[model samples]
Each structure stands twice: as C-alpha cells, then as structure tokens.
Target: MKKEKLLMTPGPTMVPPAVLMAGGEPMIHHRTPEYSQLFRELNKNLKTIFQTQNPVLTFPAAGTGGLEAAVVNFFSPGDRVLCTSIGVFGDRVATIAKAFGLNVEKLTVPLGEAVDPRIIEEKLKEQNYKGVFVTHNETSTGAYNDIEAIGKITKNKDILLIVDAVSSLGGLDLKTDEWGVDVVITASQKALMAPPGLTFLSVSNKGWEAAQNSTSPKFYWDVIKARKAMEKPSPQNPYTPAVSLLRSVNKALELIIEEGLQEVFHRHSQLAKATRAAVEALGLKLFAAPQARSNVITSIKMPEGIDGEKVKKQMAEKYGVITAGGQEDLKGKILRIGHMGYVHEGDIIQTIAALEKALIDVGYPIEKAVGIKAALEVFN
Candidate 1:
C-alpha cells in the first residue's frame, strides 16, 4: 500500500485513536442514571471548549441542524434576518432561515474572501432585522470571519447575533459570551475530534429570551423543550441520543483540555501556516486571502490548465490521502486540504508530499519534495 487512507477534508476529520477506543467501550442506555451522569459531565466539558457559561445543548444532528435550531428558536415567521455569507456553508444559514418562513437578507462577499464586519454593520443600520447570522470559519472557502467585530455591532444595538462555529469552535479561538454572540452552532466532527453524529449550541440569556418570544413552529429542534428536559430531575434529551458518539466526544474533549486550548490553537496555526507556505512553494496560489485564512482548512487554486478533480482523485485513490474539492461554482477549480482535528505536523508534511505527486500525475509541473521542504521550515 502506498499509504493509509487519511481524512484531510474540512469535516468528518480523522478521529483520534483514543476517541475511537472510547466509542468501542460498552454502550450505556440513554435514560439510565449512568448516562445522565456522563452526559451532564460532557455538557460541562463542552462549555469549557465553547468558552461560555450558557447551556451548550448537544443534538443528535449535523451542524446544519444546529443552524436550523438558531432560526426556529429565535425568530418568527416573516421576521427579517440579515445573513452574512462568504461561501457554501455560510449560505446554508440563510437557506435554513428561509425554510422556516423568515425573510432572509444576504450580505455576500466573493468566495475566498471574509465578510467585512463593516459591511455587516452598515447593513444592520439600514434594516430593522431581528437577528444577523454569520459563520466564524467558512469551511467551503477557508475564510475566517471576524466574529468579535460583528458581535459588537449586533450586541450593542440589541440585535441577536447567531454564529455558525462548526469548523472554528474547538480548533480556533472563539469567546462565545464575551463576544456577545447570542447563539453559536457547532459540530463534534471538525475541530472537536469526534464523529459526525453530534451537534452542539451555546445559547445565551438573550437567546433563551428570544426562544420565549419566538412564534416559529419547531419540534425536535425546539430549544425551550430541550432546556426543560435538561432541567429535569435526572436531566436528559427528549429523544434518544447518540450515546456512543457522545462517549467518544467526551474523550476527545478530555484530550483537548489535557493539551490545553491555547496549545491546540497554536498547533493548528503552525500547521496552517506550513500548508500555505508549501502550496505557494509549489507555484500554486491560495484561494483565501492571507488575513482571512482559516486554521482549519486551506483552499488552493489549481494552476492554470490543471484538472483539479483529477488531481483530487489521484491523491485519494493512489496516494491514500483523501481531500475535498471546492463546492458549486468552484467545483473542479480548486482543492481543499483540512488540517483540523487530530492533525499533526507530520500529517501535513505527508499530505503536501502526496499533493506534489498527485499534481505531477495530473500534468502539473512541480519539483519533488519542494512542498515538504518548505512546510518543514514553517514547522521548525
């Protein structure tokens, strides 16, 4: 075998060995007292990762479901909400809001660019919207938006701020409450180093207040009912939870805490820098701007006349290094490399080496080990 298959996509990233082992442990009944104790402790650990004192509700859904929860629990039908989007995942927030009968106004920047907080501020000034939605890190384009600045604009004006931190939460730095973010949606799959079954949200006092006033119809994604369930004597979900995934997620969080959040952030930053340096060294341009680049993933533009999809296939099938291609309009135009969640410096080095081989195989000119050498410089 050339290599073991590695997950280098933005989500469903490579799960840590410890988390996988935790998942293999004997299952526990969801309603039992033992599960109650474990779930409660998991909730507390999640809060630490989220950096908020709010109730971090874990739902047995993907990150998009968490996005829907924000829409239904806070705004009423026909209520105007401004959505700031830079890429595919960012656009999903507005799509979900529209599905719930809310009037969605979008402020979109070109792909590979971050949403300007100033633009968001100006838009809010012109509208009487109930809330503003934005993604902290756009997985599709590898852009990281300025949540702190956007949060200031919304909170000071008393408008609800909803953030999708799915790709940013555990890998990058996010201060949910301090930034005045009323609602934050995240998933266990990306930076949390867990499987894809679990989604999480951090709801502030403002968010709960909106829940009380929300007239939008909601059932499984009901924040109020879920909170009530947690407030029960034993504390539980209204429905069956993904007990095994939760156990694995707790182990992942424990590993994160043991490494220290700051250290983890630094590690990702270093790896991300290395990736950018290596891509440039190979004569490829970066898709996202340097200032807006995310610590989670790196999007690289295919060299002129090079076939992006073919290169991606070669990497996965022959080299055993799985990566993601760009979405929608950018499909077959660029390639994405994820270094979030359980990624190491050596993993990055190997990925770059594989890309060098794949690029050559796809008829793009590149010197062997050129990217690896440049990446090592950044790591050192």
Candidate 2:
C-alpha cells in the first residue's frame, strides 16, 4: 500500500489548495494594471501580517536573502552589530554580518534555550552597537526568544532591532509595530502557507533612517530603490518579479486574514501545546524549555538508545510521516515536528499516532496510544 506523504518540516510546510491553485493560474504581465494593483495590495496586506504600517518589501529571494537585505540595506561596513543566537539560524546572522565586513558580536545561549533580554541589555550598555540582530523563532532548535523584551531595551537607544521571523511570522503573535521591531524578515513558505520563492520584510521609520545613513554597497538588495519603485503611482518591481509566487502569496494572505490574526495564532498555540503534551506523555523530553518553546515547530529529544535520524526516516519512509532530525551536534539526538501553516487538529492527532508507531518500530518502549490520548486531551 502506498502511504500518504506529509510535510512536517519547519519550512516548506503544507500548502493550501487555494494557494496552490493561485500559483497555477496563467502568469500576468508585470507591467499590466492588474498586476500593479496586485503588487500594491500585496505590499499593504503584508503590513497586516507583520502588524506594521511600514511598506513590506517583496523580493524574489528566499528568507536568507531577505536576511542579507536587512543587513546590507541598514548598516554600513565596520559598524558594530550584536547578533544574539540560540540556534543555527541565529548564528547565520553573525556570519552574514561578517561577510559584509561588519564587526559582529554574538551573544549565544546553549542550544534549546532562549537568549535572555537582560543579557542583551547588559551587552548593549557596555558597547555602542549600530544594530541588534535576533531570531524571533530559531528554526533549528525550536526555541522562541523574547523579542519584545529585547525590543524594549533597544527602543530608546539608537540601536536597530532586526528579527528573523521566517518560521513565526503568521503562526506566532509577533507584534512588529507595537513591539518596536525595526526590521523583520520572513518568507513565503513556512507559516505563510505559500510555496518557496518569495521573501517579505518590513522596515520601520527608524530602520529607514539607519539605511539613509548607511554607506553599505547595495544594488539588487537595495531597500531604498525597492521602496522608491513602490512609491510610484503604479507599483512595480525593479527587477522581473516572481509573478506566480506573489499570486500564491496573495491567496495565502487572504486565508490568513479570513481566519483572523488572533484565531490563527490561537490555533498554532493549541497545536504546539498538544504536540508538547504528546511528547511528554510518550516519555520523551522536549529539547526546548516551556518558556522558550516555539509554536511553529516542536523539537523532541531522542531516547538514550534510539537514533533520531533513523526514527525520522522510519516516520517518513515506513509510515508516511515526514519529520525533521536535529542539525549539527544535535543530529541523532533530537527530532523536530512542524505544526505551522494550514495544519489542523486532525493533523496533530495523526502526527502523534504516526510518531508513536515510529517509536515502537525503532525499538523504543512506549505504551500504545498514550501519546494520542494526551494530545487529544490538550486539543479538547
């Protein structure tokens, strides 16, 4: 029998039917009035998703490229920037800054733990930093940092707060304007429930001011040029845009708004809660602490004798439950399950059941249906 395929990874999550169909439609010419209307509306609607009044720039790039744009467009070379990291993606920010010839300082916590905002405050007090980079939700370790607190610390200062929200943008309660996030980076996939190809980011007034003062060399990744193009009466991209992907993102954003922002966030919260409950019920420990847990993806620590990679493979190849294994040193030590974007309660139920079956198949001792029962209780 052929098993059903499920996408349980943190990114490239399951796409909705409406969004898929939008991508299938015939491509519209970028210069047409119809496309210009769409291009402009997309910019406005993205502000709603980001909870910001600033223009949300759309680029034909991945989240990483958006991250790079945030760096090059806002800071000059040799500027002091602090990159606070809790996992792989956070570390990537420092690397990108170094590549741009910026003086990078990293405040990294242990894997599976969130970076403390107080520590960030202490570090800022000791040095004059041009900007502070932090991950809203660490994709690798499933840890959610306290960006709001960090934002509060950097708000009164001249420091710019840049957040990586690739995984948490739509699924989590990230208040971009209210939280004072100067710049936020996200992608079309992940919680946006659209296909990979487009990157979206918002910049506040402070972020724009920094960009004006920035002497960084930028051409294609130039936010100033992108914003100027958008400011025209008929909006257009400076380069040929990904028309189909942006079309898909329009439908996805509609779905998100129709569900209501608070409702969407609540759904992710419930799903994450159910997943954590199931993991604990199955006698497996979660890699992230409760206070630092991410609603987008849940990382579970592997049992002492079980191979996390093997379990991930069995869940996919044998049971049709696609899951992600840990990265780097944590590889073979943890397994991650995504609960973001277009996921329902039934998906959670089925995922927990599949996880149980995979565990038993991997020689891990577990009582049948215990995990599912706990998960159901949480959902109920």
Candidate 3:
C-alpha cells in the first residue's frame, strides 16, 4: 500500500510525532488534578510564547472562535472600529466586526500587499475609533503586515489594538505587549505546531478594561471569566475543554521551548526563502510583494495557461503531494505552498519537484529540473 500523503496547506499542518502521540493519550476529567496541572502549564507557557506578562486565555475552539471572542468581548453595538482589509483574513476581521453590530470602517488595500501605516494613522486622525483590527499575516495572498508599526500609530490615539496573528505567531516575531497590542489572537495549527481545535489569546490590562464595559452577549468567549478560572489554585474551566487537544498543545509548546523561539522563526524564514527561490526558478510569479510576503505560506501566480486547481489535483493524486489552490476570487489563479509547522527541507524539495511535474503534465512550459535544483541550492 502507498504511504499516506503529506499535508502542505496553510492550516491543519503536519503535526510532529510527539504531539500526535500526546493526542492519543487517554482523556482525563477536565476538573481533575491531572488536568489542572496540564491546564496550568498550558496557560503559563502560552504567556511565554506570546511574550506577554499578562494572562493568555485558551479556548477549545478554532481560530475563528478566538477572532469572535476578540470582537464580542471588546466592543458593543454602535461602537466605531477601524479595520484593514488587504486579503482574505483581513476581510474576515471587518466581517466579524459587522456581525457583532459594530460600525466597521474598512480600510482596504490591494490583494498581495499590506495596508499602509500612514493610511491607518490618517484614518485614526479622522475618527475616534474604539478599536483597530489588523491581521498580522494575511494567509490567502501570503502578505504579512507590520503590526508593530500599526501598534505604534494607534498608541497616541487611545484606541485599542487587536491583532490576528493566527498564521504568523510562531513563524514570525510578534512581541505582544512590547508592540502595544491590546489583544493578540492565535490558533493551534499554523506556526504553533499543534493540531487544530484550540485557539489562544493574550489580553493586556487595556483589553480587560474594554471587556468590563462591553455589553455584547458573550458567556463562552468572555476573557474575564477565562482569566479568573486560570488564576485559581486548582485549574478549572467554565466549560468542558478539549482535553486531548490541550495535551497535544502542551507537548507542542515543549518542543517550541526546547528549540527556542528565535530558532523557530529562523527555521521558518529559511524554508520560506527556499520555497520562493524554487518558484522563481520555475519562471513563476509570486502573488504577494517581496516586502509583504509571509514566511508561513507562499502564494504563486499560475502560468498563463495552466489551471491552478488542476495542478493541485494532479500533485495530490499522482505524486502524493497535497497543496492548496487560491481562495474565493483567486481560485484557479494561484497556488498556495505552506511551509510552516512540521514542514522541513525534505518536504520543500518534494513539493518543488511535484509542482514541476504537475506543471509539465498539465502542458505548461516548466523545465522539469529547475525548481528542485533551485530548492536544493537554498537547502544546501
């Protein structure tokens, strides 16, 4: 029988063997001492990883849940919030704010680019917005925004800074408190190296203050409640947590700690560079601008006559290499190559080779050996 294929998508990335094993461990009652220890350690380590002195809350939900929590628990009806929409995830921020009844002023830039800080500052000057929402890394177009610059721009405005760092968290350097971000949201599957189903958030004093006055109907995503429970001597949660997922997260965090954050960031940067080199060597164009490209996922424009979906399908079916096509309007226009989490040099080479073959099989004019050779040059 053929071995199972490797995943190279943006989220739900390949999990390390230790994390997979931890997830298979027998479940324990969430209220028991064993679970209490696990919860305590998870909470503590998440703070360290987030680089925040404040408490970081964990929920047994997806990254969307964390985004919802940030929206619902921080703002109320009729509140004005400024959001930047340069790609898919950035648009999600605007959408979530609208769904929560906030007056969303969306500042949009072209796809494959980042919103300008000058524009954000200009917008802040025009209106007294309650909060500013930005996605640190826009996964769809592989564009990475400079949250620190945005954070500084909002500092004097007295507006709250909420950042979506779901795909960028461990892959890039995101200093939460130091950057003056009031709320930093992340998920398990991206750069965190854990499986999906768990979302994490770090809330500063300013964010907690906003929560105290917010009138949104939120019981599950309440930061105050989660923080209160976490501070208790015996760990407890307001609901039945995802016990196995949390265990996996704990093990994942251990690997992160042992490898060190700087090393993790460097690894992702190297992989991203190698992937970009491969794309250029194949005579392909990258979707995102060089300055705004993300280290986790690389989006490449499809050759004029090649179908992006066909490339994804053929790569998976013939080479056992799983990749993703573009989202929404970008469908059949570009291909997304994810290099975050457990992806390594070998995985990168295999993906480049498979992509070369897929392009050739689909009648595109790619030289069969170009991509792999370029990738090997970077890896060596």
Instruction: State TM-scores per candidate.
Output: 0.98, 0.99, 0.98
Provide the lDDT at 249 for model 1: 96
User: How do the residues 16-36 of candidate 2 rate in per-residue lDDT, one tens digit apiece?
Assistant: 999999999988899899989
Ranking by lDDT: 2, 1, 3
Lowest summed-lDDT stretch of 10 residues in model 3? 150-159
lDDT of 3 by residue, 91-207 (tens): 898998899899999999988999889999888888899999999988899899998899889765668999999988888899998889999999999888899999999998888
Q: Pick the candidate with the highest lDDT.
A: 2
Off by over 4 Å in 3: none
Query: Candidate 1, residue 368: CA error in Å?
Result: 1.3
The sequence of per-residue lDDT tens digits that candidate 1 reaches over residues 123-155 is 887878889898999988999998898888888
Whole-model lDDT, model 2: 0.92
- Clashes (backbone N, CA, C under 3 Å), per candidate, total 0, 0, 0
lDDT of every model, 2 decimals: 0.91, 0.92, 0.90
Candidate order (TM-score): 2, 3, 1
